[model samples]
Target: MIDNRDPLSRLKAALQVIDSQRKILSDSKSDEMLVRDLSAIVRYLNSMSISQASHILEKAHRRGHDQKKNQAEDFTQAYNLNLDDIQSIIDSENVTRGELESIAVGRFQVPKGSLRSIGNMEQLKMKVSTLVQNERSHQTISKLAGDHKYK
Candidate 1:
């Protein structure tokens, strides 16, 4: 005899089985691991509901779109730069506005001059310092010699 029972009773029986499985898995796992896994499962189950899942996905998509828009907005534009602004920085600092403008405008190429004068300038500075020291030494020697001659 095929007897038709309540459909809700069948759902309840399935739920009980799932609950037992969840408890068994939780019991086997460490407390921390159990909490993490259970939390993930709960989140996934909640998302399975059509409205909740759509809402989460919609929020995520909106966030991603906004992030890309913000990134695009952050990009530097050539039109935003001013020649006076570059010149002001140069006047206030050791760097020149022309050099800054050249750097800013990729098309404006500057030739790298030879550093040959750098070594020469460094040698000249060292020579000047040495000459000054030598002059002082000579003065001291001359004074000592004069004092000995007088004694």
Candidate 2:
């Protein structure tokens, strides 16, 4: 039996109970038994306190952010691209033509008409940089606006 005094402990106990119940439900042969178990599990979760629900939501939010950060790091490593270079592109309002030429021809050595099977490297880089900047700006605005809860 779980001690109901401590909210966090109770939350953990509920999760463990749910996990065990799910395993049993998966192994059950009868459809009626499965339905009953599933309904019980849903009722248990629905009975959780607001504080417990918030804690669970915060944990999920942090996990999602960590996953996205890990994926971005992996992509940067796989492509042999510097994080600073990407950040610089995102921070800048507009990348000059000279900088684009330097990156495309001098740095990457991407041949003309090689990018997107038609466009030149400079054109592709410019488009990509602009898109990144716009995305960054949008994220900044959203963060400033903050999250809103509706009744």
Candidate 3:
């Protein structure tokens, strides 16, 4: 329950919880802790129940994870690259426009549609280099090996 009896204060309190909850939800591992967080964010008498929110959001997160997993699987299947080779391309800054585009639009879903940068090698290299620096690149590299699936 909101500590404040005033209507405006109560709304402000809920807003504060919602703001904090947004950050937690984004980073949460979808564990039991999420239930506690939601319970705190929304008091059952005031708004949506914790159970309903948890079920919906957890399902959405699960679907998103599955989608990313499928996309990564398909990308690695097509590329079949060893980690050393993948790293070499990233380090060389000489990766092809097609390869960069594949990773960007196909795997990372960086703004769908044909990027004008894809036609320009220098631009493509810069974009892909940025991508390589991201955690997604590291995760994708870990998926390849000497192997085809993600760990």
Candidate 4:
């Protein structure tokens, strides 16, 4: 359970509540006033200094936070992205530390603390390769065992 006493948690919860309300409206025709109101509320909250709005949005909006997905699953959004594709890009380009950090943290939702242990591109690539291999193996096993959860 989430701690109710934490201010950050409270703020996150509030944002999620607003988001759910918006989701409900999406089932019907576009309601500009209501949608704008929700967006305004988000803007107001973002303007506040109590906490970074991104921290809340990251938890609420990102696919990586889905219960079944691992946080480090980065390339699922791409139809064609793969290990060799990424490797080729890295080899052909001067990928900076900042760019790597953004992909790891911003896109993948990988926690900064977890990324600290991986000090170089080679380490990150190897870690991802291992993860993908394991995931494929697990999927194959699940399919063979008729585990519909994976399907």
Candidate 5:
């Protein structure tokens, strides 16, 4: 139960618990502890005012999103699809510009007009190959940065 008499104080107390748990998990480098602490934080935040929780939550979400996007881009690069070949395939398949994104990601939910724009199975396979290359490149970069202090 939140103490309405001193809501700010209650929030601060919850924040203190979260901060301490985070410190402990970080220092010990324990994934299990980190997960537990993160769950606890989420639970605590659920009762808090949106204005109070938005700042930290947004920052965390943005960082995670950027990391995922970078990983995807790296995968695309590793697929080794030359620009010319990729463009040619897209042109030859009459791929819709909007649906092109879906096809690139192996998600083909093409609508009526876009249905005829899909390339042959072979061409789709080539696009898949390219996507994998980008993913692999991203993984390599992530590994290097995390494990080797590489730029």
Candidate 6:
């Protein structure tokens, strides 16, 4: 139960009123009703004290930020993905890297510029090919040396 005199209670009641007005506007069949409902909501908001309005806005902003952080943390914990890994997947899939990076930094809270140095898919493929060739050469030399020693 909330006391009617409490700031939080008043804010909650105001939000509920606004929400009801929105519902009425959505269901309204006439332009006049729509305009009236919208004007009422606007007037109610305008009449609210500056301090109360600011407090509500601040709480809403903080709540949204906390939700994003929590969601990002949960995703990382479940999928074991870091920014580099995500970038690699995005590159491999041939998707837009910039958009994905923006989402990663803005919504997922990944540190900005973390994947700036990650090479493209083509570069990664070339590096893998070079490593494979070097490994093959090393194995061939080792096999030849062993054969000669056994002769």
Residue pairs clashing, model 1: none
lDDT at 97 for candidate 3? 62
lDDT value, candidate 2, whole model: 0.59
Ten residues in a row with the worst lDDT in model 1? 106-115
lDDT of 6: 0.60
Clashing pairs in 6: none
Query: Which regions of candidate 1 deviate over 4 angstroms?
Result: 1-44, 77-79, 82-151
Cα misplacement distance, residue 37 of candidate 6 (Å): 0.6
Each model's backbone clash number: 0, 0, 0, 0, 11, 0
Model 3 lDDT, full chain set: 0.60
Model 5 TM-score relative to the real fold: 0.25
Q: Kindly report which residue stretches of model 3 are placed more than 4 angstroms away from their true locations once superposed.
A: 1-85, 91-94, 117-119, 136-151
lDDT of 3 by residue, 28-53 (tens): 75566665666565554246455554
Which is the leading candidate under TM-score?
A: 6
TM-score of each: 0.29, 0.34, 0.30, 0.32, 0.25, 0.35
RMSD of each: 24.4, 18.0, 16.5, 17.7, 19.7, 13.3
**lDDT by residue for model 4 (9-87), tens:** 6676787788778767866656978887887886687465545644555566565558336433432432235545544
Off by over 4 Å in 2: 1-30, 81-151
Clashing pairs in 2: none
lDDT of each: 0.47, 0.59, 0.60, 0.60, 0.59, 0.60
Model 2 error, position 119 (Å): 34
**Candidate 4 lDDT (Cα, 0 to 1):** 0.60
Relative to the unseen true structure, what is the C-alpha lDDT of residue 126 in candidate 4, on a scale of 0 to 100? 59
User: Candidate 6's residue-wise lDDT over 21-122, tens digit each?
Assistant: 776766775477675777787667767885877687678779999977875665455245544454454557564545454444543555656656556745
Return the lDDT, model 3, position 68: 80
Worst 10 residues of 2 by lDDT: 98-107
Model 4 earns a TM-score of 0.32
lDDT of 1 by residue, 1-151 (tens): 2122433343344445665666777778757676567657654554355455455556766999997675334323322434445334334536533333333332122222322232443343343334345656787899999889943
